[model samples]
Target: MGEEIGSDHFTQDDFREFGERLARETTLIRKLQDEGGLSDVGPVIGLELEAWLIDHNFFPAPHNQSFLARLGSEMVVAELSRFNIEINTPVEEIAGEGLARMHASISETMRQCASNAHDDVDTVIAIGTLPTLRETDMSLEMMTPSNRYAALNREAMRSRGGAPIVFDIDCCTGAGEDFTTSYQDVMAEAATTSLQLHLQLAADRMRAAYNASLLLSAPLVAISANSPLLFGKPLWHETRIPVFEQALAQPSPHQRVTFGSGYASLDLVEIFEENLELYPVMLPVCADAPDSDFKCLKLHNGTLWRWVRPLVGKSSDGKPHIRIEQRVMPAGPSVLDMMANAAFYFGVVEELAEYIDAATAEVPFEAARANFYAAARHGLGAEIEWFGKNRRRSVVSVLDDLLPMAERGLRRQGMAEHLIDKYLSTIAMRLASKQNGAAWQLAHLERHGDVHRLTADYLAHQKSGLPVHEWAI
Candidate 1:
């Protein structure tokens, strides 16, 4: 979805040609995997954070074009909506000071972005959903000026046969009523933002790492829940999940955005094969690149938007590698909080990937799926089935048991103990206080009964560089 196309309209012949190229690329991927051609330069870490630009009035600011022009940084780019922009970090090795360097890079980029947006925009903030954002702010006119977004909206509507995308979400633990609405295009997706973490790994470890991500999704979402209120109504702890899923809803057995069919097997190439068989190509913009690049396949995979997505790319040494894009976590309440979430994910996934085969056998894929929605709905208080146990356990308890394993995983990776502590301690404090971003937002709204004031205070705390756990209600 990042790549742009020449035209929004596609012909039958275009689809045919793109499909042929995609198939050939899939075959090439299999051949490479069988021949041990994938890169072993692993576990590289990177991230993309989608954030909002707000005006002085604390509402969405549609001035990203001017904002990006002023910022003039390659790390910052436009997102689906003008009110949103994505900040990307440089790829680093996940050992020693790698995590700290990521934090530094993002912090510097954010500083520059905030400094550059003094004109039409008030300042930049990173959160799951803006409390003051309204339905009118998500119209097609607010979409970023890009051919890719234009084609996505056009193709998505075509896939649904012109049916309006229906968004129906029930508040699980809030006083707000159930919310139901519809949209004629995919603009509702703009209302939700997230922090997407990337971990590049060797092809041999891809299957285990992918399965570990699926199993860990529940705890990750629960601990990182930052989105609670949408349009003045308190919704799920992390409302971004349902909003993004239903925003692009279509009448197909294979949803464009999904948890996936089941856990992966021995070979990761099976996923690409399934992509070929099940999903219809949304953007048939054929690339003029080599077959080894897998351009068409990559574009098609991008459209799928799996919660845990697999990416194929080349390393600095020019050898192919696979990476897992963890998309469950929201953008943030603070940079420190976001980095802590990344550290927990990296360490835990590394440790669990070592024993994923046995782990998956004990916990069924259906249970993992159930755990995800449960956590998204109820946050830290969510009770999820763990380790094939007949009874469910609170997400907090599950995380407490896993923190030690994560510490061990970081140690095994040769990360400095102090650096590990710096990140993991933030998670510990959040768990102990039970004051994640969602909890803080809900509590503040309850006390003040004002979304605008809630947002204003949230921004103040964010600017103060305090983690959500430390923010006062």
Candidate 2:
């Protein structure tokens, strides 16, 4: 357990302003498992994609709340930024049809919102990071007004000791050896905007599914590296991971940026155990709320975890649901691309479960770890080190190996061929073409040379809703 470093007062429970929420969280997990059959595994596929709204002049539009209100809660919700909104659609795995189903559902959601947008001033664009985003844009004034958001922001400022939104990037390959990951972490975030995808896992399978997310992080990030420039400098393909990590870092006094102990173990208990030790709570339950499930603590302050932190929430029926929210993806080249990414992870988890004794036994967990770094560093260009019947292979080739595995896997699940192909094909095209969102962004910066112009161009492209592959520059 992360018993406070030195004489440090921080403890896992030190994160709470109130303890009832934790009690609710722990209790619900027990009930949901025992009575609800939530632990009885099956793929409950779905996705949540976040997008930013902009006006005709390509400026960030703060009207997203109003726009979303017009659209209603049946499909979307406003994000932290005024310019953003999120769309979620149910997930289904049918022999190869996963991508198409995910795509159609997301697209229709966008189209429905677009149809309602008025000529006076409103448009929605799906992109990795909005180039037009300015330091002033993410200021507290523009932050979405909500208790959770405000509480998170305030706690983040105090724990992090500064504002988290505006920052820079310096990849390991850069000249400065002492560069902090926090800088790149902040810049790599979803500034331009993106289509973030969320997939649900059965309660029992949470541990394996979460570890698979860490395993897929590299490739998922690399292939979709749309965010290259931070305030207009070249960096990682998809900078959102680092950016969000830092921005969401709770306001801590020290340099202890959250890194929940390297890669997660094969089980969720390991993550929870580590998280309970390393990461602190970032958001406290509403003070006046009646829900009282207490794991009492005195300090009442903890750090914020942006990506895969534990969440305690009351569902529509007023039952507690303990689920890990995967929040690192950017908006998309298309809804199909987003879903394909989902299938890659979701399918892989299923693969691990069905064949862990044989398949996972063959693949070195460390190699998978290496593959992750390679993916983050090289993306589709990375050489993943896989334990094959022959020898180790590059991530690119390994994926070349896995597409069929994915196909067979998806097919076994009764997924439609075309659906599987639609997304998997893009993964291949991304590798072969060597054209991902990051590469395209670097190329754009190479020519435009002006951050403002680059952002404007991004706005134009996204408004057109064309995939990075199809765009003509």
Candidate 3:
């Protein structure tokens, strides 16, 4: 979905050819898995953080076109909306100072992006959803100029038989106040941003890692809940989850954005096989690349925005490898906070993957999915069923146990003790204070009763480079 297509229009013949090519590639993937053709790369991690370009008024500034041009860096690129931009970090092996290197790189890139923005644009801020954004701001005119985005909007509407894209969210404001509206276009999906974490793993370990990511999604969303208010109403703790899921709704048996149908088997290719079977081709932009490239297959898989998606990519040596993308967490309160979230994820997933098979058996797939939504709705206050527990436990308690396991996992990966403490301690403090980004935002709005003032204060604290727990509400 990040890549652009040659054209926004597609014909029946294009879909036919793409389907044929996708089937061939899916079969080839199975053959490769059987032949052990995937790369044996150890744990390598990278991230893409989506952020907003805001004006001095604290509203979204739709100037990413000129912003990217002035910045002149490959690390920063345009997103679904003109006001949004994505910052990518280089891949780092999960050992030694890899986490610190990612932190420094993104921090420098953010500084350069903020400095190079258009005069009308204020500094770029990373959040799940900008608090000052208005509903009228999500028009088709605000979409980033790209053939891929245009085609996606067209096909999504086509799937719904030209019905208006309805975004009806139960803002969960406790007074039965709901945010219900319809969009002629898919710009509503653009309103939500996220921090997508990619972990490149060996073919043999991808399954365990993917399952472990599902098991951990609840606690991760709880601790990192950032998007709370949408269009001035107090919604779920992380309203981005529902905003994204409902914004792209279509009349299909399978949802384009979802947790997943089920856990993965030993053969990770089965996940791609489900893509071939369940999902319809939204963009049929056929490629001339060979079957081994899996261009069409990858493009099709990209359309299915699974919360924890399995990816097939090429290593530096040009060998294809498998990776799991954890897409549950939101973009920031600060770079330090985001990096802490990343460190915790990588460490815990590494340790959990060792016994994910047994863990998943103890917790059913439906329970994991339920836990995810529960956590998204309630943040740290959400209670979830943990493995080997007779009753549900609060997300805070679960993290209390998981943090030590994460430290041990980082130690096993040979990560420096200081770096481990530096990052994981942020998570520790967040749990202790019970003040994630959402909690801070909600508290600020309660005290100040002004969304603009809240956003301004949030950005001020973000620029201070303090974690959300330390930010004064």
Candidate 4:
């Protein structure tokens, strides 16, 4: 999905040709599944962190292009909005100091970005939604000058029957409020940033891994909830969840960005098939050579923004592998906080996957979906239903019982003792203190009575490399 294309406008013939290739690639994927051609490697971890470029006033600075050009590095790249950029980390095995390595990699990369920042740019910060971002800041002019983004804007409007996309999010943070606005472009989606984690799994385990991801979505959101405000109005603990979904609104019953309609019943191919049937080809570039690699199928799959996304990639040995990209967590508060969130995800999913059948059978899929939205709206204060229990449990109680399970799970993965203790302890303290990023932001806003100052303070806290729980109001 991060890849750019030359043309956004496609003819009917282009769609027809793309569809034919998609069907062929789908067949190839199934054959690969049957032949056990998918790599059976151990789990690997990777991360992508999105961030904002801000000026002295703490407002979004639309200078990502100049900053990126001056930086001249592949690790940092342009994002949807000119004010935003993404930093990619090298994939590492999820064991023995891997978490520490990730923390170092991210810290160093962020430092390089800061060093290369433009003169007009005060600093680059990572947060779910920039507290100083205004509705007018999300205009089409802020969008990155790329055909892919432009096409997305055009196609999103076209899908709505040419009606302007209306983004409405109403929730209670401190006081109740509603954020209602209309946009002709998709830049509103850019206001929200994310810290996306990728975990590669063997083909056979892909189904269970993806299903476990869905089951764990709510608890993950609650633990990681960050984007608490949008355009200075307090909303969901992770306001990015709704803001991004509604920003890409279409007139269809199913949305492009979703938690998923149901569990992965049989195999990973089912997901690709759903993509082929349901999603229209937004970027229909003709593949120069479309044999075996399934370039067209991959492109189509990229367009469908499922929260628990199934991705196809090739290994260094040229064997194809499958990875589940967990798209729930928001970017920043701090690098250490981001690493903690990833550890919780890996540990919990690795341990809970053993009970998938029982979990799915006991907790209804609709309840799981509802739990996700509730957690996004309420954060750790949400009441969620667990797998084996019929009674609803507050997220705090759930984490109290679940943190030990995650610790045991990390042990099973041979994760370093010191790394596990450092990261998971952050999560535990956050739950105990009720001071995740969103909580910290809300607390500061109430005390300081100015969002710009809070943002500046947040950046200072991030630079210190302290976890969110330790950040003071």
Best by lDDT: 1
* Candidate 2 per-residue C-alpha lDDT over 80-124 given as tens digits, one digit per residue, 9 for 90 to 100: 666777777764544445557667888788888777676533677
Model 3, 1-473: lDDT tens per residue? 47999999988999999999999999998988889888888789999999999998999999999888888899889999999999999999888999899999989998897787567688898899899889999999999999999999989988999999887777653622678888888898877999999998788888888899999999999999999989878889999999898888878878999998888877679989999998899989888899999898889988989899988889876788878889999999999999999999999998999989888888889999999999999998899988866548888899999999899989998888999999999999999999999999988888898989999999889888999999997
Candidate 2 regions exceeding 4 Å error are 1-17, 20-24, 27-37, 91-99, 118-120, 161-168, 171-195, 200-204, 250-259, 262-266, 273-278, 286-325, 352-374, 389-393, 448-466
Candidate lDDT (C-alpha), each = 0.90, 0.55, 0.89, 0.86
Instruction: State TM-scores per candidate.
Output: 0.98, 0.77, 0.98, 0.98
In model 4, residue pairs whose N, Cα or C atoms come closer than 3 Å (at least 3 residues apart or on different chains), thus clashing, are none
| lDDT over C-alpha atoms for residue 456 of model 1 | 94
lDDT of 2: 0.55
Which digits, one per residue and each the tens of the lDDT, describe model 4 over residues 216-325?
Answer: 88888898888999988888899999988988877888789988889988888888888877878777776787558878888888777888898888866578887899
lDDT of 1 by residue, 1-473 (tens): 37667888889999999999999999999898899998888889899999999999999999999999888888899999999999999999988899999999988988888887675998999999999999899899999999889989998999889999998999886578999988999999998999999998877888899999999999999999999988878999999999999998879888888998899986678888899999998889988899998899899888889999888889987998878999999998999999999999999998999999888887799989999999999999899988745447899999998898789888888777998998899999999999999999988888999999999999999989888899998
Tell me how far the alpha carbon of residue 335 in candidate 3 is from the true structure, in angstroms, after superposition.
0.6
Q: What does the lDDT read for residue 91 in candidate 1?
A: 94
Better of 3 and 4 by lDDT: 3
The candidate, 2 or 3, that scores higher on lDDT is 3
